[model samples]
Structure formats: C-alpha cells, structure tokens
Target: MIERPITDWLPLTMKEVEKRGWDEVDIVLVSGDAYVDHPAFGTAVIGRIMESEGFRVAIVAQPNWKDDLRDFKKFGKPKYFFGVTAGCMDSMVNHYTANKRLRSNDSYTPGGEAGFRPDYATTVYSKILKELYPDVPVLLGGIEASLRRVTHYDYWQDKLMPSILVDAGADMLVYGMGEQPLREILKLARQGVPFSSMRNINQVAFMHDARTPLADYNDWSTVELASHETCLKDKIKYAANFKIVEVESNKWQANRITQQVGNQVLVINPPFKTMEEAEIDKSFDLPYTRLPHPKYKKRGPIPAYDMIKFSVNMHRGCFGGCSFCTISAHQGKFIASRSEKSVLKEVDEITKHPEFKGYISDLGGPSANMYKMKGKDESICARCQSPSCIHPVICSNLDTSHKPLTELYRKVDANPAIKKAFVGSGVRYDLLVDDFNKNNNDGNHDEYMEQLVTRHVSGRLKVAPEHTADDTLRIMRKPSFKYFKLFKKKYDQIQEKHNLKQPLIPYFISSHPGCEEQDMANLAAETKDLGFQLEQVQDFTPTPMTVAEVIYYSGVHPYTLKPVKTAKTRDEKQAQNRYFFWYKPEYKDWIRNRLNKLNRPDLVERLLGSKTGNSGKTTSSGNYSGRKKR
Candidate 1:
C-alpha cells in the first residue's frame, strides 16, 4: 500500500487545482452528490475516467445553486465542456420518498442532511452553468439525464415531461454507462472538433432543430417515436412509444430513435455494446482515493459512502430487466462483469483501508448472482429486441449459471485478510429455482445456495419477489410466486442443514400497475400463511423510463395495449399499502373493514386468525425485522 496525497484525488476545488499546478482544467463536472472518490459514486467514476484519458478535470460537487451563483462561476469555463449530473440517483427520488414526501436526510450529503442539491438537480445545475458561461458546452449525464433522455413520466410533478435536454437547455446528453461515449467525445474534441459537430457518438442524445436535415451518421436506421405533444394528448400513443424505446434500448444492434418536441427533434443514438471485461476493468482500476473528499471531514460522514466503502461491485448491468427497475434501462440488459483478478484486487485494496475490519460488506452487483452470465449465442442476442431475457420464461439461448459467482465468493473468502465477504445486494431468487430456470443441470444452483446460506448470511438474506399475485407478477415481468416458494424451500433446507437461523426477508410492492386492492389482500393472506409478517413493502413510485411507469401513466401495459387498473388516487394507494401491515394493531380494524367490504372473509379469517378476533398478533416465523431505513 502507498500513502496518497490530497492531489491524488480529482481536484474538487480551485485550491486542489492549484496544488496540481493546473492553469485550467479541460473539463469541469458539476454533481449533486458530495464528492466521494469511490467508483460506486458516478461523479468520481466520470471524473477519474476523464483524468485517465489525459484530461485535466476538476469537480464542483453539490455546488451552491441557491446562492448568488458564485459556485457556478468559480471554475469560469472549461476548455471543452462543463459536465452536469444529478449524482448517482435521480434527484427527485433522492429528495422524496415514493409518497412524494420530502425526506429529512440525504445519504449522499455530509451528515446525512437534506437540501444540499435542488430537485431536478441536473436541469437546475445545467441551466445555471448555461446562464453563467453562455459559451461553454453543457453536457448532461448520470441516471437523472439517462432515464429522462426522452419523453417520460415524472412522478413528483404528475406529468409527462419532454426530454431533459429540452428543459436543461444543454448542448448534449450522454446517457447510460458514459465511459464509451465520453472517451469518443474527448478524442474528437482533442482533434479540434467542436462539441456542436460531435452529434454522432453512440449513447449520446441531443436536440436537433426539426427544420434541419438530420446528420447522416453511418447506415443506421431510425425509429421515429410519437411527438412529445402527441404523447401528452394521447396516453395510448405514449404507452406505444415506450415499448419501442425499451426494445431498442436492449438490442445489441439497435436503431437510432428520434422524437419531436416542439421545434426540436430529440435524437437518441443507440448505446455502445456492453463493455468488455478489460473495458469495465479499466474504469474500476482507476486511481481513486476510495473515500469522501477530505474537505467534508468536519461536516460528518456521508451515509451512502459509509455503507459501500468496504463493498465490492462484481459487475455492471443486469439482465433481470425487472419492469419496475431502472438498472436495465440505464445499464442495459446485458451483463458486463469484472474479471476475477480485478475483483480480488479491489478486495485487497479494501482490506488495506484504515476503516476496514476484516469484512467486505457486499460482493455483488445490481443482482448478486448475475456475474459473468450472458447469452450463449452472440448472433441470437445481437438480433433480439426483447426488453427482458428471463421474463415469462427463460430464453434457452441465455446461459444462467451461478458457478462463476460462487467460485468468486470462495476465492474472496480464502484471502488471508478477509474474515467474511457478504452478498449484500438483492439476489434474483428466480434464477436459482430449477422449475423456472432449467439451465442448471450442473447442480450449480444447489451448490451456490449452500455456499451463500452457510457463509454469506449477514443476519438475514434479502430477496425481491415484488408481488405474489400471478397477474400482477406477469405485469411486473416477474415470475410466478410458486418459484419464490421453491426458492424459499431450498433456502430453508440449506439453512436447516447448516443449523443457521438466517431468515429470508422478501420485498413486496403495493399499488403497482395491475394490482387491485383485493390482490394486495390476497398477497397479505398468502404471505401470512407462509409465516411472513410482510415487512419489506413499498408503494410504487413511477420513475421515468420503465415499463411500469408507462403503464401507470397510460392505464395500459406498454407491451400489451389492454387497459391495466392501477391505484392512482392517494386514498387508493394508501388502501392497497395498508394490507402489508395486517398484523399491526393500528391497521387491524382497517384490514378487517377492507376485507369485509371486498367480500373476502376467507382472507380476513386467514390474516386475522379469525374473522372477528383481534388477539391473533404474531411476528414473522424467523427473526426478520423489516428492511432498515437508509
């Protein structure tokens, strides 16, 4: 291990820039998150990538947007562009809960304080920079920009907003894992190509004047989506547009997509191919301090950084393609996993950190067991356009194996400095169920489950079944609840064999599209029968760029044009969510009343232990305390 100077981090201030002897930075990134120089932090990754590419980069993190705009003008203007992001998460999501309530604390901010960044932070920061600099190009990236690249729903505003570029007034937008497009933009800029002329980069979106002929970029075909105005007027048209966008986004060889918003055309170029092992490794292997910028030492520690400081992400992208999730939308449906050597190197680095205590918090990714798995036939995958690879049924062309991940875990455990490495991320339990995914003839599923239960059980293992109703599960793109039963049986078998007491805490969502109140009641009743008190629950919040959100706004499934009932009113949503707490005394009367109104005496009897009795309060079968609030 080597001691690092303050200069080792990407310059977060003009003082740090002066220490680096930098006269002017090539790029200045403005982010909503407090600067944590870890790869898990998007701002750090983008800034470090630029530095690795021989660009003098400086970061202005969580700048004072509400003040007299001094923070916006501090860097003056970069030589190439000013990059803007709303941190790792969408700012609205970061600021508010699913109920649209303002959260009191921000995990990305120092001292877990809220309000450091404004809502719609990317648009706010970009607008400020455009006003201040006027000439320097404003480039938008990160999840906020990536998911909102086109016409999409905004849950907070309860409206279908046009592309973020239309409001942010930026020169260009780089969506998804931005390393590939970012490098291309940098190389072209180095050749003296102006940013305005660099519109052909993949995974980049920009507003083109509708009157002008679109630039001819290779021989790629284009798919025209319904205009923003049309989507606003017609919900059916909006729903249809999402299907096209989703399919194209997941395809390996995808068509360029365009949509008219007012006088401008939004052109979203197809994404770059999933990064190769070496490509993703290069981004992770960059020189990061792996700690928050030292200036925040007095402000107190960042909660998000604290949680993952000792964790190692094994891969990028998720093929699970859960409808409610934005992971596949932003990271793509293919998995780009890190090499074993790269993961081990990171583990060793974590061991050397002063705060590490012989434990690796997580050895997982978006979905823990998706490491190094992909389609068996490249040609089939290249031509396919389905948004999900393992929905309805697992594709035979796809390879679902847990051996690579299991082996990786064992190797990490064998490290002399490591006491335990846990898989903290949510596991896709369906992939391990033999009835659902038949690709496990090698008994890898059983072996992996045994290893995970015996070694990685950090008090309890978490999984997301999302819902129990078959109709709701189908609409959510999740497998039947029967598969979850199979998975739980296997999990419990392994636990009992090893004399372990780790409970499987399953996550469920209420008020999702196609989920009626009766469905929620049935969910509560069945889980009650299975000895679950229903702890991890949420009221679905519609975010941009997901099939579920589209359905919520459109009243119809994006894939299927048929109408799907969703709880829209506040009362309807609250009613559906109340079923999760059937055992609580506060909700016992409400549950009984609601069940009686729905004519579901059977459910009431099952949930309450009797149709009228109130003394039937019981907890989950195991020591499962719900998901802890972050």
Candidate 2:
C-alpha cells in the first residue's frame, strides 16, 4: 500500500512502535518452516507486506516453533510483535514425538509407535512465547491458531486446550489471511491501539468468555462437555459467534460445570477488503521485504532458506470444500490474488539467486488451478455450508476451468532461465479432469494440460487421490477411484510419450473412521496393481475441528452419526500397513494363497510380495526369491 498512504503510514507506525514499547527495532518474524526467498511459504511474503506498508521487517527462517524470547532475541524485540505459527502452516497436530505420541487419536497409524499429543508442540511454543516475551504480546495466527481458535475436541490430548487465545496466552489471534487483518493490526498498532480494541477490527478473531457448542456432540455425547452429567443436543446452537459473544469465562449448561476458564469465543470479523483503486497497486507495491534481511539467522524454527523451493501468492481461499478439509473452517471460501505480475516479479527475484537452479516451484493460491474463481459473477451454490463441501460429487454449477491458470503457468515456464517449473503442491485432480480431460475435443485441449504436467514434473508430481475406492473417497470428500485410475493412466501414458522419468505420485490414507479391514485390503489390492512406490501413506490423524477426526475419536462422524468401523487399538491397524511394504515374490506365494482364503485374494501378491520378471535385476543386498532373506 505505497503511494503516500504507506509513506504517510510511517508516522502512525512509529506511534505503534512506541505504544508497544519498542524503539525502531527491526521486527524479525520467526516461524518453524522454510522461509526460503521463494514463494510457496515463509515469513518473506508477509515480510514484504509489512515492508510494502512502510514497516521494517526481517525473516527468521525455520526456528524451533518453541524458541523463547532469548532464542528469538537474535534481533532484539520485533519493532511490532514477533509473528509465530507452526512451521509452513502444518500444525504440530500432524507431527509425532519420541514418546510415541500420535498427533491425534483420530490419526491413523497402521504401523508406527502410537501415543499422540496434538497440543504438545503448540503448548511448548505457547510456554516459550510467554517465557521469551513476558509482557510484549506474542500474536498467534496461521492455521493452528485459526482452527484451534476455540475450545473443541483435541484427539491427541484427549482433553481440550481452553483456546489458543486464553490458554496459550497470545495477546491477539488473527485468523484467515493476515493481509487485511495484519494491515489493520499494523494500522491500529501504529495508531497506538490497545488489545481490548482489536476485536473491533475486520479479519481479526478474538476469544471471549462466550463460546458456541461443540457443533455436533453426538459422538462426544457419551462424554460430557465437563465432568458433570449435563449435555446439549444441538451444539451448533452453542457456537460462540465471535461477533455476538463476549466474556472472560462461564459455566456449561449441558455438561453443567463451571465451563473451564478457556471456554471463551474469539470474534473473527469478516475480512477487510481494500476496494479503492489505489489499494490495487497498493497490494502490488506493498513495501514488505521479499528476501530475508541480510542478518538471516543461521538456525531457527524455520530453516526456509535451506529448502529447495518456495511458494508465491496469487490469491487466497478455496471454493472446493472437501468435507475432511479445514481450509473453509479457517480461511473461508474466498479467492484473493496479489496480481499475476506481482507473482511473476517475485519469481524473477527468486531466479536471480545464484543457488537457485532454474526451478520455479509451484505458483498457486489455496488450490493451484483456482487462481481465479469459476465465474466472477455467477451464483455459486455453496452445495454444502459445511466446513467441507457437503456434496460428494463434483458440483456442475461450480466453474472449474484451466484457461487463466494454464496461461500463467505458460508464462512462467516460458522463461528460458527457468530450467523447469512444477506445481509440486496439491493440484485438484477433479478440476484438472474436467478442465483438461473431459474430452471436449476443444482444440489442443488435452495437449495443453499434458504440457503443463510435463513442464512441472520434478521426479514426480503429487496428487491426492487419498484413496482408491469410491466409498472411501466419497467419505473422504474426494473423487472416486475411477477418476484416480483414469488420471493415473493419462499421466503414465503421457510420461512414456515424452520419455521423461517423471512419475505420477498419489498419496493414500489408511484407517479413516469409516474404513474397515476390507477397505484397507482393497486399497492394498489397488497398490499392487498400480505399482506405485507411494512416498507417503498418511494414517488419518484427526485435527480438533476436522469432521473426520471427530468421527474417529468419538466413534462417529459428527454429521452422519453412523457406527463407524474405527479401530480401537493400534496393533490391529499396524498389521494392515505392513501389507504395503511386503511386495516380494516368495512372500507373495504364501500371502496370495492365504489372502485368497481370507477372502482378500486381491491383496495376496502385493502383501506377501511378488515381482515383474522383465526389468532390471535386483542385486544381492536388495535381491529376493520368495519369502527368504537369502
């Protein structure tokens, strides 16, 4: 927001500096992710925003998310407040600890040591923030803070975290995209605004004594909201509309106990949009710094500099709400872009780096293809008001096309300096299948997408088929196996034609609440046939606000209330995962025969192990002959 506004903004910013008790210190934003100079992610982009608005900012690449004031002090007090979040927006709930703690109970672990403490990382981080900045407010935002904004079910801790706002001791929590919220915060801070007044700002969500119900407590129904015997039938009614609720704390009506101290609600006001024409370039000319300041910390929570790639923003928000996803719950379903040229300019600067080997990493917003909405003015039937898309199948009304995004990618790869460009992040295959694969015979149509995939391939391109079965995919709010099978073949055949080594990498998850032994077995069967190495086999770990996690932990999908086949113990699932690793011929002979008897002959060879005799021979160390080490 340059022009005179940002320049004029400095005076108030100075005032904000003094209000926060700081004296022209360069604020170093620290995080636990790669703050690579490139886009994709890091403090760099936000740093640029702050810079564009006429504030001083430095980036502290991946630091231990729990680093305290002393650890972060490498740069004195941030001129404003130091920004903190779980690295790369991935919550601590997704990580496990040495104690065998799974991030969440709902997290599936077909095979790994199993205890979990989803709150562990955030808690430790909260404690550190408190220890480091005793009085200085440590603002918590990003995905973790947004989703954890309320007191809800925590699958890992098996209890609750009060609310990151109260329990975490964060002075302010900004949910959704921080641009408008951050800008407002900066403006207010510079104007010497106080914490009590932050609630009034747009895009800002604060926790108060008021709270909403647990959405649907059917599964949690058996477990009281509190230790007492009371409970509510309609949790949605109890939702603490941040706009309506205000409080320090209160008692629960249903669970009937003094509601825990942390049961307050945070008012996350609607985002502030800068509609004025000047604000357009204002986003473009934002004075925030792109590269981390010269004094880049060598070691920290976010070692972004060390990562191979980066992410740049074109927009914010996703319209596609797969039920098991949190993008809607947190960011809302809106799309915001920072000018296409702005993104390209950001890429140019990245390519300028000597260490950069011409690899222009992904260029995307929430969903890469969704750089622009389907129809700017068309009425979008938000099929499901759910945090996730309510509809299982692709909504015909929602526009899904590849024209604009295709051009963007073309412009990027066209830069001869960039040896290759890849959309490494998740590409909504359903959208791709429609826009590129639907066979409209609509001019160079298929050829266009094939080129995009070819140019973006780096070893492999990742797409989340999540599962290979229709029933499981439907439950997971994803396209069916039919779609995955079709796309996989298309990609494979195309790769063969190009003679490129690039492979189609699909991710799979096991033990989702609704999945039973047969589902897992069916997936195993698909894996054998597909011949995919499967770099990632995520077990379903339920995040607090996620519908799936709720189902797994409570033994019921909150919406369906159906008796699911969630495994109660870890041992039972680990055996299933072992199946993915056993693909040898000898093992196959035994497994195939036995699996046939088990009524799961499909998984027999893959589970027991088998081999295609035609290709390169495996050496002694890696060699095998049916079930024997020799």
Candidate 3:
C-alpha cells in the first residue's frame, strides 16, 4: 500500500480527484451524512479501505436528491460501480423520534441541522443515481441495508416491506460489516466479472427470478422464509420467520436466507465468519484524518464527530444480544478485540493531535467492558445458537473476566501525554454483580468496580436497567431488577469509600413489550424510593431485526409464538410513558387519577404523597361528602 500523510482525508470533489492525477474514478460513493473522515463514521472507513486496496474512490456526502442531478453528476460515472449508504444510522431513525415526530436536529449534519438528507435516504439516493446514470451498478450497504436485507417490519409505515434492494433498484446489498464482502466484490469486479454475474459472494444479497433454482449456488444450504405477501397477509408467519432469521444470523456456519418479495426471490448469503483480531485491526489502522472533511470546517462542527474524534475503539461486536438492540444482529455476537499494542498505538496517535487535551474521551466499543471477553470454548460456541451469553443466567462455559479490560484502562492512562481515560460507553452492570460473576474465581469483580468508580467516571456513569418489571425484563432479555439493585449498592459503596460525588445514572425504557400501566407505576414508586428523579427514560421504539420488534409487529413472540401484549396506540403508550416523570408537579394529578382508576391507591400514595385521612376521599353520593362539614 502507498504511504499517505496521516492528515490527508479522502477526496470529496472532482478537484481533489484531479489533484491526485486521477483521470477517472473507479468507485464514486454517496452518503446521507456530512463527510467526517473519522473511523467512527462508516462512509469514511469504507472509502479509506477501498482507497488502500488500490481503488480510486471519491465521496459525495449528503447529496441533494430533491433538486437537479448536479450532485449525482459531479463525478460522472465510475469505471467499476457506485456505492451508496444511509450514513451510520438508518434514515428513518435519524429523521423521526420514537413517537414518530420529526426530529429537530440531525447529529450527522453540519451545525446540527435537519432536512439536509431526505427520508429513506438509501432508497432515495440509489433511485437518484439510477435515474441519472441508468447503466451504472449501484450498491447499498450500512445499517439500513443490513437490517432490511430481507422482508422487515417498518415501524413508521406500520407494515411489512420488501428487501431494500427491490425498492432502491440497486444491483446488490452488502449486509453486516462491509470489509470482507466489499473486498471480495471489488476483487471479482476488477477481474472482469460483471456485477450481475457476481451472485455467490458471502454477505451479499440480491434479487432473482422466482423460478431460479437454489442448486445454482451449490455450496450454500438455503432456508426459505415466508414471502413478503404472506407476511403482510398473515402476521403469524412473519413472527415465525424472525426466529429462523435471527438463529441463522448468529450461527458460525449459517444457511443462506431467502424470502419472496412480490415476483422476485430475495437471496441473502450467509455472512463471512466474525472478523479475527488482526483483520479488525487492519480496518482501523487505515489513514483516517480523524476530522470532518475540510469543506465542513466553516459549516460548524458535526456534533457526532466532536464527541468521538479523540476516542479509540478498542474492539468490535457484542455478545449481550439485548432484544431491543441491533448491535449483535449487525456486528455479530462474537467479540473481536484489537491487540493491546494496537490500542496503545492509536492512543499515542491521538495524543499527538493538535486538539488533544490530555484526556481520552472513550476507550470502548458497543458495550464497554466486553473487550477480550468471549466463550471459554470456541468449539462449543461454534455450535451454539443461543442469542445471549448472559441472559437466562450467564453461560457456565463463558469467560466473564474483566482483568484484561482493567489492564487496558491502566495502560492507556499510563501515557505521559494523557491525564485520564474514561469509559464513555455503557458498561454491563449485570457482570459486576456478585451473583453473575460468582462462578468465576478471578476475584477481580470488586477490584474492577473500584477502579472504574475511582478513575474512569466523568462525574457520572451511565448504565441501562431498561425496566423494573420482571416480565418486561424477561421479554427484553435483560436480567432482573434485583441485579440492578445489587449493582447500584456496589456503585454507591465505591463512591462513598473514595469520598467522591459521582452519580450513577440508570437508563430505563417505557412502554416496552409485556409492560402494563401497573408495571410502570411500580417502576415509578420503586425509583422514587431510591431517590431518583428518573431523567434518562425513553419510550420503546421498535427497530428492525430484534425480538421486541418482531413481537411489536406480529403480536407474538418469536421464540414462543405465543401472543404477547404490547402498547400500540399513541394514548396507550403515552399513558405508560407519563409514569417516568412522576416527580414533576404537573404529572401528580394525572398519575393519581390513572392509579385511582386502576384502584391502586397504594401506588398513588407512593408516587405522589400520602393523603391525610378523609382529606380527599369521595362519598357514596358521588361528591366530596366524606369531608368534614366545615
């Protein structure tokens, strides 16, 4: 690979392309986000990887799809193909809130602006590209394409939609992490294999005629899912399909997944194995400037870039497999950690930056303490299909040690240029509780807790408890609230021992599946007793490819296929969400009335305040006749 300056960002225009002495580009990539040449941004990482692989790549960020064909025609056509992405997050998730309200700001945009990217960004961008240059092949990837690679439930539309490739009119869809599949695709294309003939690559999905035989791909075993038409007509089949899709996704040796969308057969090849440590390190070691493209310097800072520019991602993938999360689905459940030497080298690089402030913002991944943590036996894990390693009690064969992570934290902070290193990502509090780690005889649980609370906390530590109800937590694949109680006790004890004032901010979700009004009331009363005002609360927003979303859309659990109750209506969901703000004076009367209607005065008194005897009681005559005759 040619050596480029660390400060050099990839070209964003034809002018930079000319300066590099490139007559024609091989791949012209388009995205729905402002160009930030940091590893945290997906577009930058993909472009840099392609550039390192001897391909001339140019990026068009946040292109205007509503206006003329200018943004699409800036670089004309490419020699190979056009790569399109919906930024790091799905466009619908970026544009709308959980309540389906249009969001006021986009973190991926310059100056925190909204409306720069259109709705359903991947499809919109791909459609514009095909319209302008009909013959060029368009490829789709990123979270939106990965999760929607097959028939999926759309929360905003409240309907089942076909594969995004069908809607976008793209030639191919690269699901999951794109490094391995992309390398193969580009290699095959460069060898004169047309994009249409490139159908056998792993982790790539495309459409075929219904009559096409499965034997065409003789090496892969295929599993046929219910057609998109069937899912729309019968939701039970839709729920059943999720079970097959999720199980295949986490398996080390997975089967190819197929679903019929209208008249076309959508075929998704099984993913490549989880990236090895060296492979992940190679992807991160690319020449990233770690700053937004210079064009955006005058447009105000990108909030997302500003937050993570100085941080080092020590690893990839999570094994937690929370039902409401897509991390495991997209990044795989196997943990792929960078070597300690690689991590420290990145830390040293960040320390030399002109913007370095003697502090590292974050040294973590999807779940911060999951570094170098995986099953004790690889052979056993290879054959296992269980989604979560910790849920339903931690696996006996799993290694839940925290010593390596603790050492990594110390090594990063030991640098003379650094003052402190913080773990900004949310840590799994369940792992710290004694009951969960009791089997492991490492004796480092308490020590790890002490180190975190003593040094890494930035005046506040964030952990998600999700909910207080046992039934809801079970549906969400989270441990019981009793574990949270134990973890909080430990956290508070460490703070007291060190004479520190850092607060433990717990995150909770409202209106999740299997939660009732009474459950939320219990949550309010319980947290209030713990002296928490409960600010970090959210109403559950169902995204694609999760157990919660399957249940929310089909009204049936994927594992059990039994009816699961959910709060679907706006009024029903809001009533449960209102309990989270029980500390506010404005919600006191409303909460009291709702609990009173449920005939649970015990909760009303607990959440609001205990009324004096006969002070506000009503009489049998439907009046306040029980009051004293004053």
Best by TM-score: 1
How do all models score by TM-score? Answer: 0.98, 0.72, 0.95
lDDT of 1 by residue, 392-453 (tens): 89999988888998899999999999998898988999999999999988999888988999
lDDT of 3 by residue, 1-630 (tens): 123442376778888888888899999999999988878899998999898889999999998788676888899899999999999898998888889999999889989999989888999999988988999999999998898888889999988888899999999999888999999998998898998788888889999888766545647888999998999899999999998998888888889999988778998888888888898888888877777887876788898888887888888888888998999888888888998988998899899888789989888898888898887888899888999888888888788888998888888878999999987888889989888666558777777788898989876787888789999999999999999889888887888888987777777888899999899999987877766776546788899988999999999999999999999999999899888787666777898888999999999877777644322221111110111000
What count of clashes does model 3 give? 0
Please write out the lDDT profile of model 2 over residues 39-130, one tens digit for every residue: 34434456667776777765444343432344455555665676766544444544642123644322111121123122344445555657
Candidate 2 lDDT trough over 10 residues, lowest sum = 621-630
Greater lDDT among 2 and 3 belongs to 3
lDDT pick, better of 1 and 2: 1
Query: Local distance difference test, per candidate?
Result: 0.89, 0.52, 0.85
Candidate 1 colliding pairs, count? 0
True-structure RMSD, every candidate: 1.6, 9.4, 6.8
Q: List, in order, the clash count of every candidate structure.
A: 0, 63, 0
Model 3, 612: alpha-carbon shift in Å?
5.7
